[model samples]
Target: MNAPNGHSWHPETGRLFRLVIDQLQCTMCTLTIHDTHHAEYDIVDMFNMPDYLANRLAIDIDKSIQIDAWIPEKSNQAVSFDYEGDDGQDRFCGLTYYCRADPTVLLALSVCWQDGSAPDEWRDRREAIDAWVDAHLRLLWRSHRDRGRVGSLEHTLNLFDFTVIVLAADGNILFANEQAHALLDVGDGLRRAGHSITATDFDDAVRLQTAIQHLSHSDEQTKSTDAGVATVLLLRRANARPLVASLARMPPTARGSAATVLHVIDPDGETRPLVGELCRAFGLTPTEATLAHHLVEGLTIDGAAQAMRIQRQTARAYLKQVFVKTDTHRQADLVRVILNGIVPIKASLSLPANGGNGSARSGAK
Candidate 1:
């Protein structure tokens, strides 16, 4: 295909530099390439998926040639290839350096030409391009070289504080991570059993179950632009703020069993009510509210006092009043009480009362 620019090929200063090749698809994942003078070009496109590309990149990398990954046998060194861009495109070229930090690379830098083949004058400008390539590659390598690697599943999951649980179509608990187990033991909010799971409200219980049932019967195995039917519900408590809970269908595995994934977020635990709201809810003075805010940020009593710019004696008095108002005895327990229970800034939530005995209903999609 002719260059989309509709001009004579000028490799030194042309559209080639815009063709950045960031993704290299393997047998594991999908990848789409941007080609031509525009990201929208689809006429000269090519597609391939198999093990041959992996094996080729492995051996050619040791040869110190332009053929890093998926380079054809006829290709020698690098820069631009005028004759072989999908048999219709004029040409393409760019650097394909490997990462020094590891045997595999998740990213790379490739600047290509879209309109025409590289000019014969590329020999004089090759050094400039080399400098550009070296600068970016070295920066990437140095940034990741010294930080040791630990990519275990547990390490990754422990980094998040959300409670996640996966269940089979029949409501059988399939997988529950460490945070999920702890949340289940917290009591009264969400309960898990060998057979099924339930929420505090009967209506919520039915809604969640029905959502999981839909996931169990899921047939779609690939992601699409169209949104699927998922359910988001708030796990409310009369005495404390609610948790945002979501249920979505996990695509079926190779063995053909689909499961439902449950996600719960406790954003309330990280929020502090406004000073007026805190004073009204827990009957604390302005100074006491300020102290409570500092404590909620995980500061010690002494630290909170210092943060609020108050004397030790005055801070102690404020803390005493805070404990009394919030109904907690110790600083640690007081922290939990304030953060998880007292002075919660809740949004007004109203669920329609359908013609049923229960006061709640599921807001499933």
Candidate 2:
């Protein structure tokens, strides 16, 4: 299918990769396979990324970002990708490939490339690139659906630092990625120890289930107002460490279609600093500082405890201390203060959204 953009698909992967490297003004790129429980896709190899200083920008793959796509029958899980040990860098970039309703592979590509020398042409096609990537995911899903577990996408999705899920019209747990699996697995108590529940156990997951039901039953206008996205942080890893989660409802429909997407993220990197910074800046008690940090950073009190490797009660004490010290009336104020203090370094690229709407997918095929 011809994309709204003019570029034609390249049948060969090698040719497509090479063309992307040459035409897109990226310092370097590679292709690889990404597999997970819910979704499988190919990845744009970062082979060339290491060669260029620009590539070192960490993609916060651990951070979860889910967006309710305005497009029909689609939603996106934005995974944060980041370079480790370079957290202080002002500019950051990561790749998040989009997947479709069937949970089939979508385009696997990097996003927000921070390379300073990147050409205008590459930047100009941002929307087209998104569209193309979306198309790739759909095409790849179609190509591989029959193969099942035996086949995977030419691209890859990171189990860690990424949120993978099969979206339905009503936000059902169609499927999930490795990271999602590790996160959602809830072990039974000693008596029922062996038993476990996956993503369905999450508080946000249940909320999402409720929201989906409401959206599916409600009319469009009611659903639109009622339907919204939320961010939730869950406990991840075999140890069940705390991570952030986001749940968003898209425009509603009665077909049980997903109007929203859910994302889970690990904010361990920003946790300590965020906490310590609040304490130092506000003279908060250590407990207050710690509690303030986690709460503001989007962790639940329980999640903060698990993250801090402390007991929930102990975490609660710290939270109270934080409240008293900060002299803040609400948690929202605390979050606002800290977020405001954290500066954002942004880079912009003009894409051919208006006239030059070239299709990057056409080249991929």
Residue range 10-104, candidate 2, lDDT tens digits = 24444445545554655444333333232223333443444232223211121111222222234444343444324455343444444543542
lDDT of each: 0.50, 0.46
Q: How much is 26 displaced in model 2, in angstroms?
A: 32
Angstrom error of the Cα, residue 229, model 2: value is 5.8
TM-score of 1: 0.34
TM-scores of all models?
0.34, 0.28
Q: Which 10 consecutive residues of model 1 have the lowest summed lDDT?
A: 24-33
Q: List model 1 lDDT by residue over 1-365, tens digit each.
A: 12123331223212222322212211121111122122221111112212232222322233322333343232112323222344554343433432232333322222333344335554555544554444544453444333323235545555455777888767788767667788787755678655667887677677767777766775564423112446888876556777788888776667777777888877555454433354335656667778888877778889988888889889998888777776678888876765555433222211122212221112211
Error of 2 at 255 (Å): 10
Best by the TM-score measure: 1
Model 2, position 90: C-alpha lDDT score: 39
| Residue pairs with clashing backbones, model 1 | 1-88, 1-89, 16-112, 16-113
